[model samples]
Target chain A: MSVLQIFRKTIMAVVCKPIAHFWFGLNLLHKERLPENGPAIIIANHNSHLDTFLLLTLFKTNLLHRLKPVAAADYFLKGGFSSWVSLRLIGILPVTRERKRGESDPLQACYRALERGDILIIFPEGSRGAPEEMSNFKTGIARIARQFPEVPVIPIYLQNAGRALPKGKRVPVPFVFTAIIGEALTYPGDRAEFMEQIRSAMAALKEEAPQLKWPEQES
Target chain B: MSFPFSLPSNTSLTAIVLIYGLLGLASLIYLFQKQRGGGSDELAARLGSWWVIITLMIVPLMLGALPFLLIMSFISFVALKEFLSITPGRMEDRPIVVAAYLTIPLQAFFIWLHAYGIFLILVPVYAFLVLAYLMTTYGKVERFLPSIGIFHWALMTTVYNLGYVSYIMFLPGGCNGTAGNAAIVLFLLIATQLNDVAQYVWGKSFGKRKILPSVSPNKTWEGFIGGWATTALFIAIVGPMMTPMQFPESLLFAALMPLVGFIGDVTMSAIKRDLGVKDTSSLIPGHGGALDRLDSLTFTAPLFFHLLVFTSYGPFAMSCS
Candidate 1:
């Protein structure tokens, strides 16, 4: 591992993991379904800042060195200290949220990372939404999956994160959240169908672990 | 300060050795049973984990007070994590969560510093108010009361109550001298754990009536009374040598241990039932989670600590060099 990766691991083990475990009571279900080797993409519903931390804690320590989360550059890499934290501490691949005409592809960094056999975590919803509800998925995940058909797209449903550390909240509320990893999917040469497949897979996961669902969803 | 290895002349080395010897014998019996095709894998795993747990518990005692306190804090952190992982609450209570996590180290630090005033009220008073204030700032009113209530209870039980175990080392020496404090902690641990095992063994062998069929089906009147009587007898016999307590006080302490421990175990069970989880998490091999192992300790520690204090056997009762 590089020195930065080592440092990141240390901080994660000592500080982040314990705090997350203590506060959110995080549980990762079906983690064995995660691909062990080669390039893979993890697509999950996003509702809290805790989405990435919850995802990171699920992987074995050794795999962490090869994992990079796809974060919005405009938010995470705003400048200075945060940029350094986004790049070094958590190893985020910043995808620009907005691009001018003739600008480079925002997902180019993600594609290069996948080419190098790194696991990329993508929030297909594109931004945080209300707790227990999902937004319409952006087609970015489909584009990447089609480009690299060999890379398995693993669908995950992050339950209760929005309630744990909802948008506009720096600290997380002490709530137990779950990361439900669904079966992996490959590109079927139809982008819309693929995105719908991923979305429905997550929706199915929400039903499977209904205990993690919000009270409103139950009603 | 001298290393704990120095073994103060008054330290109860005999009690320590006898306990481990009993554990060794139990392991041997289990092994022999396994050879006869009678032992289950779950029992074997439980015993295996017990060996690691026993060593972890004893090493810190041998290292001295600071290490013991730090280890207790770590245990509290794990227990709290398990409890929180099973509880259902809001996402907006992040501030309260941070405050609760921060309280673990702060509570341990208080014990280390022997700041009795702040240590006693930190969670029940200050933390309670701080969490309330934090919840208000979040501006999300849904399930607000229940969320704050859970947070407060988690901190109180996990951090505040468990933290009392470390304070035993700081207790004033009574008839056995300063080293007797370690013996007091060892006594509580032995009695609490023995009560748990004895209750299980007796319940399995002779139990017929359920004590609380709704909360815990496994618990029975036979087991409750049997475990209580046996553990109390053990404490009464061993108590004079290991603790500052005399025969009668030891008997009282013994009786209280299992009763409170029963409460703690069932309380966690009720929470688990409410949360719709069988076990808190599959963290430990045979044991369910850190919370499962610590359920008895949570209630016993605070009660035992207060009993010592009320009986004039705590740190406040005597002076140290």
Candidate 2:
């Protein structure tokens, strides 16, 4: 094995192994929700740090398959071995959310990854929002759906990622959690209409678990 | 083989006795407190068990036995028992054989003897293969493979990792000075425990951002940063006092130690979730069972041991020299 692979595995063995050990509490509400094959976008609610690994472990796929997680450039890819492992070894695709005017858009990296038949995980609630309700989602996901209208967009509601690793906390309180993968929402043709459908679908997904109270319905 | 602190001295012995006595009393009181409310028996149980862990760590060291091996075997046995108790095993299964429990003590004994070669291989390779062969000899039942595999891996990870504590204790030049030995062991323990406490404190106090919402709900960015900051500070401060290493180096080691320990804690949390249980067992009041207690130690032991082993000496001569 290459040195990079060895280092990645070693770090994963030490760090991610525990995450897998602790948070396998996920109950897939709809296994059939995921497409059997082809490129897709997994749009989920951002909650805790555990979101990355837990989703990776719970998402349906052959054990042999690999999925790329699109994480924030500023946080997940923070300096040192932590970043290297997350991006390179764990296959997280980093995207910069905020940039100066006329700068490159972050979604390009994700758009390319999705085109390659790789699944991309996106948190539409720009960042982790309040526990009671999801913040207004950024239109990035809708735009991506429109861009790759052919690819399926899987709506996933992570029941407790927010509570597990709330917005500002470091330590996760051990609790039972489930990653509910709702039915896939394909890119509806109209830009405005499609955004509304996706938002309602995500909100409906959040309702399945009464534990999370979705924010007031946005018009 | 004699420990320096083991020598006779009434003052030192009395002080040791008083300390342990107070701790034991506190544990009992904590146990009683649990019974009183009629609501906190679980916490009481955990706290009571924490006494034993603390005792094993502190009392023996105070008495000068340096009973590190004893503690290792005990933790291994306890954690293994916790694993087996939760997991069902058939009486007829050879891997579930009586010989397995017996091996717990023997493997511990090998570790005590510092037999690295035999100790490491005994579980994963030899014992595992033997158990599998025995299972095969009985003919393959449909559910047999997975059942045997889980049992074997659980035992191997729990018991073998426990044995590794011995390897850690004997790391060459890792414990050169009297103070150095105490510092290293204490530093490891403190880092592990402090990581848990600090994370909880941080998460509880200032958590707002959600990092992973599904697996562990209470983890937060605020808590992570605050806990990490405090832990790093503690590491820097306590690192120098406990070891021969200078401030920044000790600080760096301390910081890494807790991060590693945090990983260990979460790993066990994940395992418990898979098993569909909480707190491993009710063996400890106010704390979880042995598995919960040993969770951090399992990862911490290997990490701390390896760090010392590699830094102090080459891989080839880690245990023996």
Candidate 3:
């Protein structure tokens, strides 16, 4: 194996796996719904930066090389060690968060990755939001789903991840977070209705989160 | 007469054999129920859980103090993790949480080294001070007082409380005591678990009135009494084989242990009810989380240890006990 391949493999086994499973433990439901091979788009509610790593760790270890997390280009890819780490160590598919009319295609990389049978991980909520609270989702996920009708779109609702490592928090307090996976959906022909369907699915899944109220919530 | 792996005492060997023997009988019953076309999935799941807990406990427990301390430390880590995961804290208090977690290994190490004084006060004194200092710097002044109380309570319940049980294994004569260090631990384990089972069975069979309906609906006065009586009887019979306690001395523990265990169970139930969670997590089959399964220990282990310390062994041993 190449040196870079060995490095990534070691990092995944040693660092990535422990941080996801131990540091911020996941109580995964319907784990079998996560496929081994993919030409799939995995979408989840984004509340923390840790969401990307949590989802990435859920994939089959061997197929991990094929998993690509969709991230914003301007923010993550300033072209340095950060870019290298994001692209190689973390393996992100950079896309433009904002754009002008007829500008360079932000989603071109995602299209190519999907065509290569690589799984694309997207957060419908563009960025991290208030902990344990949901924000209005952008229609980017729907756009991706529309083009790949053959690929199954998986919805995962991660609970307490935001609280585990919320925005601006360096050290995470250990918390048992549940990852509730919803049934896979295929493109529903219309973009607007498809987004609505995904939102409804997320809402239903959120309700499924067992009435988890902490002592602080009570007070 | 001693088996291989240098088991601490013959009593530990007997305990291991008894555990497996019970497991074997349970399997037979499970098989018969399956043949009878009954859905005994919960029974089968419980058997598997018993296997996991037994292995996690017995293997390390028999090896010696170091391994036992290691396992106790691990349990502390998992219990702490389960606790922190459930209780929501401010992002600014992240440093305090990390500091809390870092104490698990140090506390475990102290017990292994028999630094009784330090082990007794590490979490209560040192860790608490460190967390307070961090919280002062990290505090946002929003919910500061309750937050301090949380960090201290979490450490005490998960870390300091269990230290007493682990410390028992390091007693000078513990390794060669009547049954061995493990016998004492095992006695505590079996007694606590039996009390739980006795209460459940009695409640189902004869319980009419609830004890604390809001905190724990299933717990009843009948169950509580039935469980205590059953456990006390078992302790009266088995305590002599495990510890230095005479039958009369064992009776005192029997009465107190079951009562304290009941307290622990309801206390945890209160936490779950407050948190609005059914169980901490489904980590252990047929039980709940590590916290759920060992909740009774949170109260019983320390109380049993202190009783043992003051009456049976240690610097404070009383002539009567």
Query: Which of the numbered candidates is closest to the native, going by highest TM-score?
Result: 3
In Å, residue B244's CA in model 2 sits off its true spot by 5.5
Lowest-scoring 10 consecutive residues by lDDT in candidate 2 chain B?
B7-16
The regions of model 2 sitting more than 4 angstroms off are A1-219, B1-52, B64-66, B88-91, B94-97, B172-174, B180-183, B244-252, B314-321
lDDT of 3 by residue, B2-86 (tens): 6655645778788789978988898888888889997477778888899889888888888877788888887888888777766
TM-score of each: 0.77, 0.50, 0.88
**lDDT ranking of the models:** 3, 1, 2
Q: CA shift at A33, candidate 1, in angstroms?
A: 3.6
Instruction: For residue A135, give model 3's deviation from the true position in Å.
Output: 2.3
Model 2 Cα lDDT, one tens digit per residue, B52-130: 6666676554443237666666666667655654443443453354455567778866665656668768888877887
Model 1 lDDT per residue over A1-219, tens place: 678888888877888788766645655667679888658999988988888988888777678878889988888877899799889888899888887899988889988999899999999888897776788999988889999998899998887677766787665555556667899999999988897798789888876453632245443
- What i-RMS does every model get? 4.0, 15.7, 2.6
Tens-digit lDDT track of model 3 for A52-108: 888878876778878899999888999989999998888898898887798976787
Error of 3 at B29 (Å): 3.0
